[model samples]
Target: MIKKLLELSNLETTISLRQKELLELEEKIEEKKRLLKQLSRKVRKYEEYNVAEKEAAVTVAVEAEPDSEKKVGEIARTDLVRLLESGRVPQSVIESLKDKRYSKDTFDLNFPMLREVTDMGKVDELKKDQ
Candidate 1:
């Protein structure tokens, strides 16, 4: 009887461990899905910008609605966040921006399309994810 009880307890423990691992795997899967969606959106934005490479030169055109009041040449902050998360921008560039002392000219020079970022909260979230 004691041996049977011990075996049952062992089985219960195994079940619990497996459940925990399953939950972890689910979370990882969800994260991957989110990343995939973000990448898809980035690709679409690139298409809208009309970025194309021809004859070893790149051309970019930003199209906006006639009634839109957005600045003539500026990329959205969320787009920048996605770009940073996508690993297209080198880790060194992100590291350099970590310091708040960087001048606007330097920032503009590095990220020409990004005129300004109002919601730094997303950047913080991106750092936390990394």
Candidate 2:
């Protein structure tokens, strides 16, 4: 009977050890789940922050320029004739000024005398008058 009691006690000790191991494993699993949840929350927050920053930058760029105007080219024959008849500019210069594709810099670079005849404001004034 004493031998039987000793055997039963050994069996109980083995079962107690197994139960402790199982409890430790369960605790480790719970800790991993908590850490995974925290990491997922951090990732989602960063994604939302990145999207908001990009949207704000785009909005700022669009709103920065409200009244910016583009410069358009204009050349009128009537203005060219008036400039020519005024005796301030030559006939050849007047003929060359008929084309609207040429800017003041381009015309002056091609024919220096054209620059002396019509002031830079002449083309702009003629466009406004028309």
lDDT tens readout by residue for model 1, 1-51: 999999999999999999999999999999999999999999998765543
**Candidate 1, after superposition: displacement of residue 84 in Å?**
33
Candidate 2, residues 87-121, lDDT tens digits: the string is: 75434344444544443454433322233326665
lDDT of each: 0.54, 0.56
Cα deviation in Å at residue 78, candidate 1?
43
Specify the highest-lDDT model's number: 2
RMSD of candidate 2 to the true fold? 21.8
The alpha-carbon deviation from the true structure for residue 65 of candidate 1, after best TM-score superposition, in angstroms, is 26
Give the TM-score comparing model 1 with the true structure, all chains together: 0.39
